[model samples]
Target: MQRRKYLKGMATAAGIVTVSSTGNAQVWDSDELSKGEEPKNPSPPRKGDSVMGLTDQIDTVNVGIIGLGNRGFSMTQLIDAMAPDKGVIKAICDIREKPVEEMSDWIKEEGKNDPPATYSGSKNSWRKLVQRDDLDLVFVFTPHQAHTPMAEYAMKKGKHVAVEVPAATTIQECWTLVDTAEKTQKQCVMLENVCYFDIEMWVLNMVRQGVFGDKLTYASGGYIHNLVAEYFFEAYWKDWRSKNHRKYKGDLYPTHGLGPIAFYMGINRGDRLEYIASQESPETQLTERAKELPEDHWAHGADDWANGDTTRSEILTEQDRQIHLQFDVKTNRGYSRKNELAGVDAYHEGFPSQLAVDSEGHGFVDDATYDQYYEEYRHPLWVQMEEIAEEYGGHGGGDFLEIYRLFDAFNDGRPPDMDVYDAAAWSAVRPLSATSIEYGGIPVKFPDFTRGDWQNKRKLQVMDFDTI
Candidate 1:
């Protein structure tokens, strides 16, 4: 893992090379590219060469979903709920036959006129689903490692992609996805459901309306949970998550916490992530907990878990906005994303969700004021879809809202709420954090996946509630 020098004009380069495994790049600056210096690595698209406003008007989004695992299977309900009107599931795929067959049967039981075509039995089976011309949109809910390649493949095959969170595991993979999406001129959206959470949306609306004051000083977020009992044992299909914990040292699952904060701070739009430094607590609990598992369990005798009990990362935005993120799954703690925000005039925090405004000296506002703010600033999307979201019920209805927005964007022939740059920038935190930790918590430069275009401010589609 050789670290290349951070190029001075990477953001301005006409063609940029793929990042190395160590999160550094061997770039071809605009001068070199203009002088006919061929880049050894594949080059990413130039600044402002983006799929930001890419559009293809489809009357009905013919959907294909790969990976019929737990998360994938659950998403079928959301897709089903939107079928015939917004989109229809045209194909389904998995490496295992059981889940694929089960999904097919479920589609049949749901009385779809055309039960989705199923593909399975081989690792490459998903390519069949992606290659289907009938599919206008593809939802990739595969494991973390496969997300980037799957998304790149789907986009190159002429289908819009909506992939599950943390779309790429490495900086190189992030560049690959961004380049593929740009080359294909197709939408590559990361399905970060947390951005659609009720509190998050409401706070976003408030921030836009100046409720959080003019300058947002700092924010805090985390993906803190205790997963040893379930996810480490039987939850993940092949112990993928546990295995990742055994191999990786950074914030493996960062999007759940980072996505909402990015939206609040306008990452990859009006602001860019400049750099991050990360440190982790020593590994202790997971090793001790591994002994409790049966001998046949994957973690039964595992003592060399690369992940520590906790990891903390501090990020600086180009606008000088500070963000603090925490990741921990080895602890026996209650679930929380820690969503916290602060401004000169107001402050808020999620998980018991308190709000205070008017002055920093003032403590949290009374319940009455908080409830009033909710009534006054409730996001229009939530206002319109709250009933259905609550009924569908996934992650306090954020999951349904996320799916709704995806299909809604497809139906209207508009850019999704999150595009490739957003996906790449958010997911890059995983690798960037890991690299920082690897170097004893030195600050690692964060890639501007949007290139220099992050300087241009733009409105988020999610804020435009009147459209969908």
Candidate 2:
């Protein structure tokens, strides 16, 4: 693929152009557009308005999901169950042939005669899938490194793309993905499953409704895990987690922790990310253990590739709010997926082992508060999520919800809840935080992925499944 000279003004191609309004005039460029022109009729408002009074688009979006690995396969199944009536999986691609065949077989077993066409080969095979005229959206589920390139190619090919978490691994890649999405005028959603979790959504609603009252001095976002036993170390692809282990030694996978917090805190929305300073534990357990093992062992003699056990990034939002973001992939101790939000009036917490919300005077309480809360504010569409989970379950019903929203956005012609800017903001933390680590844990400024207009942009369209 020829790397086009980076254009300064807006990019235009194939009648699909990104126009940015600086001052009172609109400037345009065509370097990124497939054909150096703007689409004659760029996505217009849908015709028939729905009960939610949202857009009236009803096109059946044809999807092609690339990199059918574990997450991709789960997303495919979720899409199959969630939006069967709204969209169809037209194609699936992966570097490995086994996953493609497995997904095809699964589709057939589900009684769908016209299973999505399967393609496998090099990393670039994704380009072919995205370019297909039949595909409206492309899901890139490959490793972190491949995300930006695939998304760039997909958007240029006139296909919307939804990539897995940690959208890009470098600051440059993050800006490129965001820039290309805007340049191509195509949707680029980051599939952050945790954002769609039931508990997280409930908390968001509560926060929005002022149930949390003025959030102040919050401690949220943490990842406590022992992933050394995972197949990531032994995979045939030599997963980037194993390959580039040394380079990204701090908060390498911060999205899992940062996603929900950013949403709740309104980062890039009501609040903007300012700067973050990170600190990693001096030594890693994996490195010490690896040194004790024989040289031939999978992890042995790989001390140079080991990252610190714990990385804590302190983020300061433009709102003057503080966030304690923690990412750890070492140790088999306590299992925790932290999502604790502290506020002036109230607080909510969610670790993998438990969930809790507290008011200042109330002190520690039981889980019944959350249960009652869920019962009261639960969206009617949420029940459908359970049904979909029964049909295809993964990641505690999160995988299904992610795909459900993807298809829902496509059919409704609205930006997804986690759109391009959201993807860039959430995932960019990985690289920015890494930069902080490289600079002796100094503060790193997060580049605004939206280039400063995300605030004026409409709130992402959350699927209103109530009427469906």
Which candidate leads in TM-score? 1
lDDT of 2 by residue, 1-468 (tens): 112321122133211112111101122224534444432212222222211212325488778889877677777777666446877788989988889999999987886437778788776677778878987778888888898889888978978788887787766676666667666667777888887777777766666667767765575787787776552346631676666556556677777778878777777666777667777786566566667766676677555654677889888776667888888766766766688887665677776323345543655555686567777755444555677654566677777776777677667666567766677667767766665666566555566555555455245345344333
TM-score of 2: 0.82
Residue 112 local lDDT, model 2: 44
| Minimal lDDT window, size 10, model 1 | 1-10
lDDT of each: 0.83, 0.66
What are the per-model numbers of colliding residue pairs?
0, 10
* Candidate 2, residue 314: how far the Cα is off, in Å: 0.3
Model 2, stretches more than 4 Å misplaced? 1-58, 231-233, 292-295, 352-360, 367-370, 457-460, 463-468
